[model samples]
Target: MVIFKPKRRVCKGKEVRFEITELDPFIWLQVNSESHVSYSIDGFIIDSQKKINGIFNKYEYELGTTLDVLFETLTQTFSQEIYACASFASILNTEYRIFIWPKDFPENFNIQDKLIISIKPVIKDKSIDLSSYKLVNMSALESGIKKLRGYSFSNVKSLLSANSNVECFLANNTGNPWPGDLDALIYLKSENKTIALIEFKTHNKNTPISDEYIGKYGKQDWRRFEVLYNLQNQLELAQNHKPKIFYVVWGTKDFDNHKMIKIDIISNNKVESTNYLDRPAFGESSMELFNLLLKLC
Candidate 1:
């Protein structure tokens, strides 16, 4: 009996280094943990340079779609004109095409772009040759928005403390919505304005923006932008309510290498703060969230 040999693929089951074909038309490109995986866009690129306009790479998704599936876990938002949005939107829209180089790169590596890729790890680049790589799809976006991608709780505390008001709140009563066990909620408060809600997320096991957060908070509609859906409900409870800012604080143990993300929401053209708290996990970067509550509270 003759046995047939299996053909080997180029990027088989490994993290493949790649770049976008162009910075325009398509503003953002990301990498995944494994090679040969379809990469996706979490948020569209902003094109800070205004090189190619017409909302390149910034397409809206259907609410229940898989790309938003990760955000559904949020069960998180509130009153404020400042809508929560993907902090990376600006980065994604950058003019500079970004790419992932192998963890090991020669110091002589040179890269630059009119626009910058805000969140980058060991790998960095400017000229992304998309013709050589594949388009990043949904799964890749999830990997890019990894739990460790945001700012640390402590760093968020410091940044906002210096630039904004803050409130350290714990449930006076039991059964707090936030996981008080982690003391994870850091409310940025200034007088009546509730600046934002910061949650420190650092476990190696990343949480889905939709699934994890909703599950984290009793599986309510915690989808990041989906929280805007609750605004009417919250406003009906009162009135004159606006969107709240939210940040998923991420860290790596030491206070360095922190990233804060503006949780995406639908409404208002700006970013505001949120109302939340949680316990700290080691190796977390400060997640920067915004909200209009800061003006009120």
Candidate 2:
């Protein structure tokens, strides 16, 4: 095994280091816990180099698929652990790549509390060249989305529609662009063949739930619910399936706990909101969220 130590950098005026280990099937890259306080590294090894290489070569340039494969591989390898964290893969050389996660790094150490490392690989020499390293913060909404990638959702579609011609959403008008995009639009393969529209939001723990936040549709300029209702109609008509629309808002500080709000279209012009009481405080983990979504279907 060959080990390489990346350069130390000052995070929040304190030095931090990351060590990279070249293992047989997968690369082990983790933070040097000694330099930072309250930091720990989790280790899991991939056994088959051939399988790793096959996955790397197949989805080398596709970040989403690469991440999905990483999640699938980890879940299969470790049955006792949940890897619902932000992680990215980097191509070290022609034959090897590294997947890294800054799990539980100190909050004040970095601006966004997330670490970024860029590598330049020399294929001929088979060595990794570190070009830059920095710390940035990942938004709560984005982190939630990243966590969702760990689960296997059938026929998953994000803000962008599957049809290139339809653009971002089916309800979007060519003359007037939709206010915002749905966080996720997923097709659940159940007896009913359900479709779900999910919207994610990040709020402070102290933020009170108000009409402004709930966002009444068909009232003033708050058309998110209205647009979602329109989308629900379009999808139901197009696919001949039941469409369920809901929004999840999580506290920035306490992300594991979130509130689910269900939206109902009372009529062609009216939309109403109701608490998703089935699971009031949901999302202890990504798997839990996935299970809850399946139950909702």
Best by TM-score: 2
User: What does the lDDT read for residue 113 in candidate 2?
Assistant: 42
- What is every candidate's alpha-carbon RMSD to the true fold? 21.3, 18.3
Expressed as tens digits, the lDDT of each residue in 1-297 for candidate 1 is 011111112221223233211111100111111211111221222122312111111122222233133123211211111111211122223221222221111112222211111212111131112232233432243233332222113222111110000011111111111111111111222212212223233322233222223234443434433333332234223323332433343322232232221232223323333333232332333221112222322
lDDT of 2: 0.30
With candidate 1 superimposed using the best TM-score fit, by how many Å does residue 170's alpha carbon deviate from the native?
19
Error of 1 at 203 (Å): 5.3
* lDDT (Cα atoms) of all candidates against the true structure: 0.23, 0.30
Write down the worst ten-residue block by lDDT for model 1: 161-170
Distance from true location, Cα of 119 in model 1, Å: 45
185: Cα error in model 2, Å:
2.3
What stretches of model 1 exceed 4 Å from their correct place?
1-200, 203-233, 255-297
TM-score of 2: 0.32
